[model samples]
Target: MGADVIERYVTDLGSRLQGSRRQVRDLLTETRDSLTDATEAHLDDGLTEAEAQERAVEEFGPVREIAHEYQAELAVAYGTRTLVWLAIVLPLMHMAWEYGRMLLIGPWQDFGTMPPAWYLFIAQANDLTSGIASGVALVALILGRILARKYDTRLLAKVGAGVAVVAVGTVLLGNISIILATAHLDAARLVQSAPMLVATLISWIVIIRFGLLARRCLSCATIVA
Candidate 1:
């Protein structure tokens, strides 16, 4: 009977929250651990098993209130994870693509020197895309940590998600602009070889992965009911 109460409470709490699977599992595990410890302490104090469990549940607080707190934590965790990916993975992917290009194709011909000014502008923007995105993500993360307690978790989560989306969007647009410009100038450079094609595919995949994570952050934040 006591076990049933705990199981029921955990199930209900789990049902109320949504986010990364690993995060939800971890929080639920902690909930079980704390409740178990409380029950054991009550038992040591000489209460019957059922009575001890009942006492434990009471002290643990109502499930609805606990679920609200857990959901907030889940939202924050999801947002932080998205920010870290933006900070680290985006820049790395950009670097990898640049290095791959250099290895796969030698420096451009006179095109490198005499590309049209608009093309040059787009190329420079593409070069800075990842760095700018990563910098914004890092700043947002630091600010989030500083203001975490003062602001609501859901708001922080939504803000983090928005930043992530904008960052990724910037990178994506930069890449597209560079590619389109390159295609217009010399389509051959766009697909130098099979290896370059594969590298480009991988870069796109990484960007899509980050975009999905950012989307999930918003989903987790908005599900406040």
Candidate 2:
């Protein structure tokens, strides 16, 4: 029974190793094909299959190590892309929907019939804060992309720190603005503004998630390097 168990464990490990090897091989092949095509176009020089294979393998470093690195990098890229899209599209849609509701149903329907000046001030503050946060998140996503490409650990850490700070600051500012606006308005109006609060919370979560992803990617890079 012990021998059988040992055999089964070894078999499972062998299968996993085979799957990993195949994945790494596919990635290496794609990388090599792209590079070879570009090199041929730029230099009008073609490499033999053996030469190209050797060069690609050399550039990719150790196969096992690079496979692990690629896994982390791909995860970070996927997460960052999701966060970027959410940051860019969600806030704008929220603001537009809020404004549309106010326009159609009147400010009282939404904001409890506040003075026009107060309405405008609140709207402006909301838009400004949302825009700033989205912009910062977008910038951080871009920086994360750049750092991922370069595998720059230090820069990734810096970008993550900046994102965390901006996300926290935006949340604080948004909460304060909402409180101040609602103080002069009815409690019911504050409750009506829950959508904005929810959106802000979602944005905060996305920012924090992506920031953590960046930091984790950087940490993995440090280990690999």
Best lDDT among the predictions, by candidate number: 1
lDDT score, candidate 2, position 119:
58
User: In candidate 1, what are the lDDT values of residues 1-225, reduced to their tens digit?
Assistant: 765777788898899888989989999999988988998999999998888888888999999899878887888888888888899988888888778777777555534667778888999899998999999999998888878768665666766788888998898899899888999988987766799899899888898888888878877877652
lDDT of 1 at 119: 88
**Cα misplacement distance, residue 181 of candidate 2 (Å):** 2.9
Candidate 2 ranges beyond 4 A from true positions: 1-75, 107-123, 143-161, 168-172, 191-225
The TM-scores, one per candidate, come to 0.83, 0.45
Considering only N, C-alpha and C atoms within 3 Å, which residue pairs clash in candidate 1?
A: none
The per-prediction tally of clashing pairs is 0, 0
Error of 1 at 25 (Å): 1.4
lDDT of 2: 0.52
Report the CA-based lDDT of candidate 1 relative to the real structure.
0.84
